[model samples]
Target: MIFNSDTSSDQVQSEFKGRVSLLESDVKQKNCSIIINDLKEWDSGTYQLRVITLPRAGSSVWGKRSCPLRGYCNTLVEGEISAEAGLCVVIPCSFTVPDRIQISHIVWFKCESTKWRCDHGDMIFNSDTSSDQVQSEFKGRVSLLESDVNQKNCSIIINDLKESDSGEYQLRVIGLQMEDALTFSQKATVAVKGLSQRPTVMIPTLTEGQQTTLTCTAPGLCSGSEPTFTWRWRRRGESDTDLTGNITAVKTENVASFAKRSSSTLSFSPSAEHHGTNITCTVLFQGNVSTEETATLNVTYVKEVRITQNASVSEGETLNLTCKVDSFPPSLITWTKVSDHSSRNGTGTTLQNNTFSDSAQLREERGTATLSLFNVTAGDAGQYVCTVTHMNSTWKENVNVTVIYMRDPVITGNLRVKEGAVLNLTCRDNSFPPSHVAWTQVFDQSSRNGAGTTLQKNTFTTGDYLENLRFLVVALLLLMIISVIVVNLRYWRKSVQQGPTNTKSPSGFSNEPESLQDYDDVSNATARAPTSPNLLDDHTSEGEVEMNFPQVRFTATPRRQTTNRDSSSSHQDES
Candidate 1:
């Protein structure tokens, strides 16, 4: 059977004229040609073609020989193809010839692997090969791969080829010749795979206060694509900035492998400000995918400051001032006196005796500035300012000073006093600032309460006799009474020792008998006189001659002794 490109199998017999009246068997085109340029797994299926034919006659003129005869002519042809995994293959197909025959229909089929059977659409026909005869998995993807359907080049291309496409493919063709009906079997296979995976980025360590360089390397074989590298820096309050670097690629034999490495160099004299800032490197691959790495920057800086001096001060006084600040470069120091005072401006005098030093040592090596003024006077005192310079910045501190004279404390009143006397001593001194008042005494070693006695009442009593006259007088009176009693006793004893007879004797008294004799003579004379007077008167008369003798005797009579003597004498004279 010969199939026309534009004709259908149902009208095939009338459209063709032949000697043999072709009776085309009604056979579905089980296999159809799948023409695919960009073949895929979905393009896999079975296909077929169909044809029909009719009888032909010849006639002769004038005497005759024209005859025509025909029998029913019919045919059917079928074939099968298959596919594999991960590969692209074609389905093989062909057709038989027919005289006065027109092949019009082609069809294809996929036998169910489990049932080993086919359905209606599986038995494809040419006119409706465009119909939903193919399996759902192979519907839109399967197509006619060849240019001419009449030639029966039923080869096809399948792509994105997968394992599931591996199956039996059958083809069926309908035509007029009875002997043209045949089935040829063959199979093909296809395969598919996944793409390559992405790669990782590597980074290095960075130190503070130095230049740091970071590189981001693209991972995997970047066959036909260029790896793009970029860097970003993100800090606390700052926006991100792109970091650029030099990029390069590596290759091996036929496979040109890509390695995208970018380096960003941050050259800075690090400071504390740079700390905790995030520096990152981002690498973009094939414009869609990216890899990144981040690092924290650490910066260091030294402390710094500045100092300045104040203007105008007095003389002869101390000025204390300071200059302080904060920074990184360890502040430098310098001193200058500002002489703006009206008194010192025209005068050729300068008050620059101020000294400078540091007091507190900063633990971070930070310290305090101290300005000292000694023996300051009105001219020496004014505005003294301290200046400190650090990190290109200058700071100044000022102090106003006025100098006044001071005097030592002077003792005003007497400080010495007797033990119990009231002490009133005053100490006074002259000074710019008044001096303090105080009282102190030089202590006496013998006094328990110290040398100076406070102002208070005092009474003294003397135990010495001379000190108390009444006591002395009483002692003298007792001595006088003792002496009087002693004198009286001695005199009484002397009186008792003398006798009373010795007390009566007279010094002129003599123990003589003259007075007694005189008295006795007188008494004798009186007795004699009485006797003699009478005798005498008689004898005197009788004898003058006897008178002599008698006179002796008369005398004896008056002074008996004398008279007797006289009488004895007279008598002796008479004898």
Candidate 2:
């Protein structure tokens, strides 16, 4: 170290050798300033410099006093600090003034990194001074941690931080004299980042139509400004909607010595519409800094099981039915058909078909299930049941499925019968809802009416054939003629055998009979055979002619009766 004193006996410490120096020529003008090169944080305390003068003649005067070190009025502060928006940060700062220098006030100034000085407009806080010169935004937000600056605690607390508040802060101390005032060259840097701390949200188990409360707590404890809370609901496929009007919101703040607790609680009744929707709790702080937490709302609910479908399906067509249930968590749907036969368990199982190996096909979605019966037939017709199982509850619904069908009709009776016989016939058809069977007489082309002539009844009958009365009379005459012819033929043949003679009988006999008998026999043989008749009569004549011909008589009888009687008589005779 180079000494500024004129005496060559001056000494320097080993640590300060070649690093500390004072100009001797400048000291001649009463300038004893010393320069320290490559100074470090450890070199920041008090330092003294000693100067010795020539002793007065005879009487010696000694001068020993504390030497004030120039350019040593230092301000201790952090180099950098990081803070989040909507939170608080403490910038620790402390400064010292030269001994015997009365401090007037202290001022904090914010400046950009490139600027070396801050104007009066950059002053954020001033101690023991009017606030007219301090920035309006930081007027109440900036406060000293230690109100007594005599304690050397210049640390300040900035609440409700903002992104624009990031910069370099310088501490300036104003003393009573101009030489006592100083501004620390070492400044503290602050980095205010965007709000990243989300609000804490508490949600409870919610049920449909049940009132519930949700709590939201804002982050940080600055105690600068009261944060505002907002509640919003976002439904599926829709925008967010404010729930302030529909819900009750309560805000509470508890301030302690160093921390401030701020929270909000929202109360509302939940419904099915709130299920699966997102609800957000946002906390807004000073400078429009905001943070939010979102949670999905789950409302437990259950609706009745509904089965919709066309119960009546034509045969050989497909039958489709759907069962649905609305609940918080989707319910499980099961399809079943009521068994026509007695089931061992009473509860029916899945539908089964003899023709289809895979009977009813089941398809499931979120809240609905479909049962499809392909190629439906009469066997597929029954009561179909749909069951839904939700949380711990089970619901059921059923429908009667009908398969429309009809079978070929059949007539169960004899097809042929005699004219006078009693005829009976019945028509039968197998079908759903039963078919109506009627009898109709299908007329031939020869009939005046075409096609079927509905008899309007089921049975028909015919009585005696009186239309054949004239024919019966004609038949009787022919039978009588036949009997007379037979008598004449026999008499003629007897006469021929006994030889021809002309004689008189006792009963008015005549001798001219041979020619007449021959003529009569020929005429009788020439007569046509009796026509087929419904009836015939028998009669006979008696006398000498009756004796010669052995009188024969003929009676009329119904053709059908006569045939029957003959057959019966022949059987009787044979027996």
Candidate 3:
């Protein structure tokens, strides 16, 4: 037992010595400690350790001089950490060691990784380094709360903390043992955020002709400078306009933290024009820091519907129809062909016409609805109604599509005619606007007048008449052969009685060929015109018949009437 110091062992057992014990004095395994229940000021002293001697390999090596107990152990006291934002967060840090820590200078560094050690510095503060060595932004900002770092009070203070200055910070005592560096322990983390780090915007559904309110709250959660709020609107095709006149602004504080936050509410009657317009809330912070949040308004309304389609559509062609709907919050649009039977009913409107509704082919994009009718027939051509139902409003528009079709030109008339007959031909076609018709011979490719004598004149030609003459000539020649045969068959004795020489031709011996007018069956030239100018030339192709004075008939009576002829004995040769 050791007593309070009164000059050492002389008083070791003498005065009030009840508080000391050498409980673990066994030197064999080198275990020796002096336990103190409650520390007092007088207990801080060095005492001699005495034990029986033995070799290290033997029992009770407890007494070995080499294992004598002294202060050679290490210990530390670690403190808990807590931090705040927008305000400087102080992390109380203090540490103690069994051995006196010799430090040259204090250095503060910031690093995200705090494993094992923090050697390289984003050095924030260095007590011994030149002022230039510290980052300019942190030069005067970082400091120690306690001037005497040797006292192991490692607390620090950072003024005017920024959100960027949030993270783990490590303090290093340059001269401390490598294992004793504060970087070896879990680092203190600081988090700095604006009282309201992010702006809050609340917008609700707006309907046309209705009053609505939009609220915007600038960022912050704790007490501090209130931010200035401004409201603006951006409509398509229009410049941005400030809306502060309709906006009411008020400063609010969080009851728990006494943190200040700003809020602004805008009141307005919404119209269709305001639909899809951007409402921007800009918060101006201290130091000219500004941020903005934008929200688009969706106002619902419906207006007149515009329907469009091709005026002229070909039969069996696909019909393309577009219905433009001017409404916010796009609504359903149905395209239906209006029926002739469409009538008003008590329940609703119903179409009764022979209408084909292609509801499946309806497609809507943006505010326009498109419908396609496939393989349209002539019946498909009619009035198409585009009905738009948006919110509680309905709009309708009608489009008419006409199917155009045509038939080819058709020619019809008498095609068969006699060789010399007039060729009466006609061409006809049925069309919406009358079509041009013409008659042309397939062989000559000649066009004829529509309905006039001029066309008859063009076809009335001699070539056809000449062909008729060819037939007539053949028929007359056959008749002449028959007549000669008949003349040869009939023979009778005759006596000639001459009155005078009168063959002197009735017209003085004609030499020209006898005109075919003798046939009388031929076409009369005076009745119509000459079949052709060459008709005369064709009739004159035969040699002319000549007439001469008949041999002078003697005045003598018929003397030889019966001379050479006995009845039926001698043939009568009149040659």
Candidate 4:
């Protein structure tokens, strides 16, 4: 120790002796160390150390000064650092290093784990190695201020923040003092926001009857807590429904930014029932705060068409047909009727046409269209088609229309016949899809019966050729019978006109018709009427009749043979 030159040599020796201990005091190699023991709070201020070295060749003694000893190691003051999920953040810190120490490297680490504890709790950075071993979660997301690193600036700016980044972080300064390397720690806390950013839901073009998948991405890439995703959809004319989805945890980094992106996906098959609906995806974060996104689903689909109308309509009746099409947006519909008909113009010449013209009226509404045919007739019978146009597809449906009618029954047969003659009669009707036919007799209610088929036309009793001949013969025989009766009556009346009286002649015989009374008794035989003979046994007999005339001699076999006093001169009988 060197003191003032005026001080007493004994006093300087006495003050230095046993008052200080110099450790490893090798002057040849320029080694200097000093230690103060039993320090008190009162010793807190700056205290400097001085060393003197002498060369082996008696070089001039050189002196150097050491840094002031502080109360503790270098310190870094840090408050809470706040950041958004997709943005960035900066943690400001500084430290005081002893002047003799040399800085070699800087390091940053994070610790908030429960599973497998990371070495150094996830290495954020290491300045010594350009590409240091970093945790998979923090790689490329951390950076140190290049200009301020050498100036004891331990502050770092981390980009691409995520919910998982919310935790305590400590910075380490690795450096060499003399030949030994040392490390110092400064801890800071980070608070990342999961609700600052909203989720984004993407909508894709959907088709009917097609299987599709949709995706919804949440705000933060990763989360401090596993976030929950819920999906809901509003169907047409139905209540809201919850859908189950698959979740994904993604962590990524690049030169521009680094963050975690969590997403959910839904798969389903769509049809017309799902048209015009809203889909919502909600993300529940660590706290009560949540993020939600909604998108309208515009499903491209076409439902099967349905036609409402009567299948069978009568002729001359109005035909009303309706076609319905359910689909997204709206559909275009057309009604067309087809038929085969010929038309005549002013020149009275027939024009050949197979398809009907535009004579019917068409009406349309929301998803349906109607075709009206006014006062329809047989000419309007054919197939009608409804063509539906939707998106890029076209569909057609056909409906058949038939016109039918029944004409009046026509009688075309003999109306009258003589007795014992066959009568033929026939009834017919011209009809489409025919009608039932039957026969009826005027006198007999039990004779009428329904007999015949739906055939368009029918004939009755045409095969009986002998029926006509029987009719003619009966007509001629009736004339012959009238002549024979007239001749007999005339002869009897001439004989009565002679005015003869009953008298007795030779042989005691009465020649005056055997007395008028006796003649009356002989002529009193039961009167027999003239009757025609049965001509055809095979022919059907509708009815029969009999006549009584005993004096006429018209019966081929008389009921009483040889009455007393009967004349046998009339051998020729009524035909």
Candidate 5:
């Protein structure tokens, strides 16, 4: 060691003794440095300074650091740099000068690359000159790392690099003295090419009739230039179209010295038409370089159920119905008859009354269901439902069925009545939506009056009536018969009380009384109505005779016929 703490070598190198000395200020600051004066061109080379720090009282090992210094002006830089179009890049660089040299400013120039060196080109950035001196295309796009410049860092960041920007770059350092200005011999080669990076897109689950937003982030994280974004949509089997009206786009920026990012958000409502379509997000940088990302849109959607069939059907006619629904991912369609008690079978058909056979068929491709009843009846009149199940939701539609039917009309009450008697008749029929009843006369017997002439005549009568004279004649006859029978019955009873009567007449008949004989003669001449056996035996009380008088009259026809036949036989015997 030539020197150590307060000690000097007795014999020192003649040229280095006076020129080299320790820097006390650097030592007080916990740094190791030395001062060398009169640096010349021959001394331009790399010099390494190393310090071995003795361990504290408790340790025995020593720590050391190697710091390198260069004489004159020089730069440390990479020979080649990689960059992408429409993005940013950083060229890391540093410089050194003689110990006493002070830096005034820095300048950067982009030049065309030649085999041996760089050709004269445009100035991209300058610290000591006005911004006007820089190229128009590169203005405000090239910036120096300001805080690092004082530490001899010549690093620069280029925003929105283009293919034309690929070239050799030179850095010049200016000092106070005219002889101190220097240009670095080593150059940085920027290989800017077409942008191959794609934008990052984030999308959420989309649903029809729902509003959502999509986010697109550009490639670079440089703060120098802001990027623009665009949104487009391409329907399945169709060309791309710009997404406009009803869509909102917002651009956001995040900038800092070390980190910079740009992004855009797109918001809109999605519908069934947007399902299975492609949506693209494109990012554009300052140099007209663009990148894009595409994603297929999948939307969940459904439509209302519809029943397109007439509900009114005539009895004994075929009742056919169809139901349909539109939806995405298809849908389950079902047909059912709505009744007080209704159920569905596993085959997707509803059964209201198992008594009637119903045919149900489903065509999944067309999303339609059909229900057919071969012969409709009153029991088939009810509400029918079309049910649709899509995704996790369900919907239904209903129709009321009407069966048209009617029965034959009927007439009730007396068909014939005595003259001047009021009669009542009722006509009725069973039918759906009740049948209309009317009585129109096709022929009038009273108006013809046994003549061929047509006569319009009106006869007032309460109801159906028989002729008065004919009724009276029949009544008189019935009275005469009843009187005779009463008299004969009295005589018979008298005879019975008087014991046996041997009285006989020339006619070979038992002689009762004159009234009895006359009753027999009258009965023989006119047909006598017969009395029911039960009536004669019903002599338990005399009041019964009167009670059965009407019955006897109505029942007298058979007896009258028998008497007429006896009279006819006697006549034949006499002939």
Candidate 6:
């Protein structure tokens, strides 16, 4: 029997003897195969085939003896790897060996260097001299590819490959004996890169009379070069166009070559035309490209303006006229005061003093000007034209000034007076322009025909003495009537209050009997007195006394007083 090992140690040993037995001579044949009991990897050294004759056809009997094999032994198979960061990496290793060799155990190790060796099948990792026993960072991360170790496919899968796991890896195999242990190592370098890209914006919209700003940011995994920024406006139902306004883009560096980066800001003033428009920003890189989202812009406005004034005004009174126009730029106002009679092209008068006088010409003011009139008069009253010009158009206001005049005055109430009383009369008249008043009295026919009465016309004057005299005469007559009535009443009352004997004689009376007789005869001797007078005297006798004939030699008789008393007594008795 013959055995041979290629690309390995050159030795021939027998496993049945339990010891190494050296061959006496070198084997010198090619294409040789060797077989031995209990074959181990250490016995896998090179061997040669030799032929020896034992005197039976004794002339160097050689029956196709094989020479020592001179070929390389390949235990390690070519491997393929595929990996992603934060995920698993498969190092696929499969091997085909000579049928004499059996793969007892398969193992995986992080390949630090070519000089270092570690344990293959054990749970612990043994380094050169001192056994490390375990790799702390790579302990749980290391896993076998297949569950069947007999297959000799020593592939490995590493889960959760961290940044530190970005090194080489190797595979090792162990036979049934320690001497049969063989390492078949293949290095696989792992690279951990971050995620692909980040999120972005979408379509933009805007309204009329509004401002808008749009922005798009680049994806997460970009680095080095500044990401190209572009803003494009895609109108609704139309193609996109490049924005011309201000644009800005920025990029920052981080740990890895491809790191977090962003591109942003595209701003513009948009109109309703930009509604439903799409704005986009695109970023480009060496291996990949990304686009920031699009967005729609919405816009709104504040407010606007409308028109102003009082339409009517009175003449001879100041007029305040105004014109208002509605606009964002403040519409211009032009005021024109036009007369019905005038033919002026345009009223161009300026109110340097802000006042329009009666004598001043009517004019127009431009650009939000006010038309004001000061001390307006009757002639100044007319149709005033206020023309407000704004946005290349004119708005007109026609104001009519009405001249007002004071109304005439009226006097009211009746004149009162008594009969036969001299009266002073008042004449009053009311007029817009005050009027002159006069008074005159008309006499009756009887007074006119009087002999010495001359007809005269007098111009009655107001607030004059003659005017006052008429009133005074009426007042004096009323006073005189009242005085006369009062005096008569008082005299009658006094007469009644006195007793009959105490009553005094009225004026024009005489106490003498002769004067009384004379008066009586002159009035009427036969008539009795209207009033009786009481006289107190007791000297006369009661009897009648006889008178003698005309005193012719007749002497006056003196009678005794006793006899007169007796006679008076007799008369009294008889009476």
Which is the leading candidate under TM-score?
2
Q: What's every prediction's RMSD, in angstroms?
A: 45.0, 26.6, 31.0, 27.7, 24.9, 34.1
- What is the descending lDDT order? 2, 5, 4, 3, 6, 1
**Candidate 4: clashing pairs of residues:** 221-260, 221-261, 526-550, 527-549, 527-550, 528-549, 528-550, 529-548, 529-549
Tens-digit lDDT track for model 2 on 1-575?
Answer: 33434445456555656566542122322234454554557768777676655554432222111112463344343235777888887676666665677777778899888878777888999896565899888888888877777666677888989888999987787777887766666677888889887876777888877788888877765668888888889979999996543655666554545456688888888888888899999989988889999998889998777888988998888899999888868897888877866444567876423323565577788998888888888988888888888888888898889988999998888889999998888777877767666555544542457435444333332222343666688778876777666554444433332332435344323333544333333322221122223222222221112112124333221122345345544544554
At residue 264, what lDDT does model 5 achieve? 80
Off by over 4 Å in 1: 1-209, 221-224, 242-270, 305-575
Name the 10 consecutive residues with the lowest summed lDDT in model 4: 343-352
Writing each residue's lDDT as its tens digit, candidate 5 over 454-502 gives 4333332323134656777888998888777665544443333333334
TM-score of each: 0.22, 0.53, 0.38, 0.42, 0.47, 0.22
lDDT score, candidate 6, position 266: 60
TM-score of decoy 6: 0.22
Clashes of 2: 8
Identify the superior model by lDDT, candidate 2 or candidate 5: 2
Candidate lDDT (C-alpha), each: 0.41, 0.67, 0.54, 0.56, 0.64, 0.44
Error of 5 at 39 (Å): 61
Write model 6 residue lDDT over 1-575, tens digit each, in one string.
23333325345333334232222111221112222333457656555556443453312232211112222122221222333344334454555445566667655566554535534432322222243555676665555545566665455555544455655555455566676655543344455454233335432444344445454555432223455666667767878787655455563535232233354666566654454456666655433444345565544321222224443444456656654443322444544445654525655432433454453433333234455665555555556555544445556666565544344445444467688776655445533234666454446663667633433464344656577899789878866665454344334323333323234446322222221222222212221111213211233233211212222111111223455345444544553
Of candidates 6 and 5, the better by lDDT: 5
Task: Give per-residue lDDT, candidate 6, residue 107.
Answer: 54
lDDT of 2: 0.67
